[model samples]
Target: MTPDNFIQNQKQQSSTPYPYPYPPPFSGPQPVHFSQYTPPVADSSILSHIMHSISSIDSRLSKLESMDKKLDKFDGLCEAVDSLFTRVKTSESDVKKTHYSISNIKLDELNAEKDNLWIAQASGGSGSPGKGSKLKKEIAEIHKQNSELKSTVSDLNLVIRPSLAHGCAVWLPSSASSQQIL
Candidate 1:
């Protein structure tokens, strides 16, 4: 039989009322079937529905790709913030250590000055008053310097806190040390 006759016979069989109903037409991309290829003429509404579905899927895929790119950017920003946080912590530690050492040194100096004052006052030795006076002056100067150092450190800590928290400033160890002008 010719190809046309065969196709016509197939159409007739599909139209007949059989015990089992025929499968509905494909609304998606047509699949290649048999040696003789023929495009299935589907309903226009089915064609529109298929086209709309394909476009909707394409749009969703593009949106997912865009979200992935944004996620990468957000991850990079988080890493940068985390590194800055580490640096700020290190800087605060350094500041605290320096303050502690200075406090210890000041305490030692004050103790020594107390001893000198006591020794000068105990004995009626020559130049005793002069030595005591000098020691007092030195002690006073050390106290003044200590207070100033504390103030400076407090100011630096305050400044560093906001700058680091805001993520606008990145503190390298070397640079942070240099900026600690106390």
Candidate 2:
């Protein structure tokens, strides 16, 4: 083929799916017996075989690219599934029970703090004010911590667990007891 015709054919061939660092069309493997004046029939057969090999290589390259994309998505899905499993397992750790215990502790501390304040006011002692104020602040901090913990526990129960389940994946925890680390 003339150079002009070869260039035009290459342009058309490039529009199809091909891997990066595309192969040069006219720069195919050279024939071993270039010095020999080969017969036209032999030349034609060799050209056909080379074309077939190039086509096969292109097909395999396309398949590999597609598989690579699919494997990336699979990896992302696996990571999401793993994180969901961890959250679900964490939610089952009696968080609600822990929150309840913390609430009780906060309430008892608050009552004690109030009683100390009242005693300080009734007795008119300068020494009791510092202890009473410190107790009150500690109680307030404990209450705040308890509030955050409860909110976190509730959100895990009401939101995260259901949302994960809705995504068509089942994040199952191991049946082993909680004392064992996985």
- For model 2, the local distance difference test gives 0.73
RMSD of 2: 38.7
Best by TM-score: 1
**Top lDDT hit:** 1
Q: Across residues 1-182, which tens digit of lDDT does each residue of candidate 2 receive?
A: 99788777777777665533465454655576666546556688899999999999999999999999999999999999999999988886778878999999999999998887688855544647566667777888999999977875665466446656666433223431333111
Please provide TM-scores, in order, for all candidate models, with all chains considered together. Answer: 0.46, 0.32
The local lDDT score (0 to 100) that residue 115 gets in candidate 1 is: 80
Q: Positional deviation of 138 in candidate 2, in angstroms? A: 51
Q: Each model's RMSD to truth, in Å?
A: 32.6, 38.7
Model 2 misplaced stretches (Cα beyond 4 Å): 1-42, 94-182
lDDT on C-alpha atoms for all candidate structures: 0.77, 0.73
